[model samples]
Target: MKIAVMGAGALGGYFGGRLAAAGQEVTLIARGAHLAAIRERGLKILSPRGNLHVPAIPATDDPATVGPVDVIMFMVKNYDVESGARAIAPMLGPETMVVTCQNGVSAHERLGAIIGAGRVVPGVARIPADVPEPGVINHSAMWDTLVFGEADGQVTARVEGFRDAIVAAGATAVLPGNILHDLWRKFVSQATLASMTALTRLDLGPLRTNPDSRALFTAAMEETERVGRVAVPDLPGELVRKEWEILETLPDTMHASMLDDLNAGKRLEVDYLSGDVVRLGRKHGVPTPIHEVFLAALRPFKDGDPAGLAKDAVQEFRTRT
Candidate 1:
């Protein structure tokens, strides 16, 4: 299958490199040092499952250069959904499937608005992976799964083919009957984890081990689930507990991508993750104090502190006092 991986960061590089190694025609869209590194040394995937180094792979920054493709693996940060969707117009063939493996729920709708619902496939990526540096993808977790399906819940030939392609590349793939529920299930845990870890500046071990922090985590998850149930009416009441159980099974060192962004002083996806929960809660008349606090506290750092302007401001204020 011909695939175009839009945004060749951790998720895109790892999965796209695998597909390319499997002999599928893949073009990775990336920019700056990452793109330069891939073009020079190829994309590298480091994982416990196996390490893969595709010494030579097609990569470019412009989607139009790739032309049309059978599928587009959209893995940009949540905030880049609309711009990413619009940027990939040249890659959208009539039957091209654009699947988003992102952190939030609204990406599919946002992509569908630009590229049409038929071309947008709702997907969830279950992998703890990141680009520790340009051209190198670090898959820290043993689990690598991609779940997706049509918006209307039909098991179409296109989705099945894409699933098979992903599985053939040695990654787990599923075409669930209801992708929205799966998305919300992921969001429940993701929002809580991202907000808690980013705000506290701690990993999952300390966050889950401490009694006070654990209670805060549970409360945040419950509030997100409450808002989710209203947004997705069929979402089960037991989803909160189910998410908590899943969280327990993860490695203690695991942390959300938002925390990674925060630590690296990069822009965060909080507006789309925790901030989404707050927005939906307001729409449905659900109270989300936990999420509200998370958003408010993290808002200043959403776009990062490149020059330490925030730090400088704090220092100046301290001197004034």
Candidate 2:
């Protein structure tokens, strides 16, 4: 079970570090100060489930330095998808399973172009986390897990072997029944939260508790679901309705990774999540006024605004995490 985790940030750092600690052979591709810290002090995982220090994790700046691998866990943000794909070419063997644990639905398609669809697997990451600072990942929730499967739903040797390897790493992993649907459902959830949170400058807590904000959140979800159904017409409407109920239970303080990225002034995945929703809505002639408005309001903060959101005004529309 030789695993290569490309993009060793929050999600990659947590999963890859845990796998390496549990004795799975994991190679992480990272760079800059975060990479230096991992190499110097090992990976510091500040997780509620438990803390771990992966003292001997293997990492490098270039995939060529590591050579071909068995499982390639793709964790790059949408902004880097294309370049990340090109970078991974040297590490991929013919049979390697490149699992994408990124947001939205198009990551597999983009990676497939780079590494061929036969070798691509789409993965969904369920984790509430962020990199509070370089080399330190603040995982507020402990339920981080990874689910991925073959594009054709065929339990090939590669898929099965990655499951076994992830389990051996003391981590929760599964090959889902309908991987595409899983990917979309995650999109519906994330787009709603990310757009709502970033647009309102409100975290999950405030967004869910206030009736006005909560209804607005539902509107955003409906917009995402409408566009998704148009793009993937076979998706069930009832499933999305029921899924909305499931989302209600999420802690109000919870925020999407995109919101955290926006707060940090880093390049965002806007083009994929909220931006993609708007794009598909236009492509399929679905009206997405709510999400469009959200995108319009938040796009400004991504580049020039460097202050932590204004507190008094934000508190009027925000709730504490």
Candidate 3:
């Protein structure tokens, strides 16, 4: 299958490179030094499963050049959903599947509004990957899976075909009966970790262990669940509890990707994760005080801290005191 990865950062690059290595025609859409490095030396995946180097996969910044493909992996950040959706228009064939692979549940809808709902496939990616440097993906965990399906809950041929391609590329691909519920289930845990970890500036190990932080974490999950139940009406009442149970099993070193972005002074997806919960809560008459606090506190850093002004102000205040 001809595949185009719209945001070929860690997540997109890892999967795209693997598919390319497996003999699928995959093109990476990226920019800056990362794109340059991929053009010069191809993409590299430093994974625990095994190291891989796809020496010559097509990499470019323009989708018009790649043209239409069998599938488009929409892996851009949550903030870039609309712009990215518009950008991928040149690559959408009549039956091309545009898989939404960002955090947050609303990406598919936003993309659908721009690119037609019929072609949008809701996806939930479970992987620990990051671009430590140009063209290099640092995979920190062993859990690597991609769960996706039609929004209508039908197991269509296209969905199965994509799953087969992913498995052939050496990664797990799950086709859940209810992708919406699966997406919300992931959001419950993801938003909780993203807020708690970034706000505390700690990893999951320390955050989940502290009694106060643990309580806050549980409450945040509850807030997200309340909103989620309304979003996906069939969402199970025990979902939050089950999600927390799974959280306990994750590696202590694990943390939300937002924390990584926070430490680097890069953009955070708080607007999509916690902020999405706040919006949904308001619409559903659910009180989400915890998520509201997270949204307010992280709003300033949503774009990024390129000049370190926030940090500088805190330092100056400390010195004056």
Best by lDDT: 3
Candidate 2, 1-321: lDDT as tens digits: 788999989989888988888888898888998888878877878888888888778988899988888888999888788999999988888778899988888889988987788888999988777777667777777587789998877787778888887777776788888788788887887887877776666678887788998888777787788888878877766655776776766786777766666655666677778888888899899988877777777776655344655334445554753
Q: 210-320, model 3: which lDDT tens digit per residue?
A: 998888888889889888888788986787789988888888888888877776678989989999999999998999999999999998899997589756655586699
Least accurate 10 contiguous residues by lDDT in model 3:
309-318
Candidate 2 weakest lDDT stretch, 10 residues: 304-313
Ordered from best to worst lDDT, the candidate numbers read: 3, 1, 2
The clash count for each model shown is: 0, 3, 0
Q: Where does model 3 exceed 4 Å of error?
A: 310-321
lDDT of 1 by residue, 5-52 (tens): 999899889889999999999999999999999999999999998999
- Taken over the whole model, the C-alpha lDDT of each candidate is 0.89, 0.80, 0.90
Can you give the lDDT of residue 67 in candidate 3?
Answer: 94
What TM-score, to 2 decimals, does candidate 1 have?
A: 0.95
lDDT of 2: 0.80
Taking all chains together, the TM-score of candidate 3 against the true structure is 0.95
Model 3 error, position 62 (Å): 0.7
Off by more than 4 A, model 2: 301-321
lDDT winner between candidates 2 and 3: 3
Score candidate 3 by lDDT.
Answer: 0.90
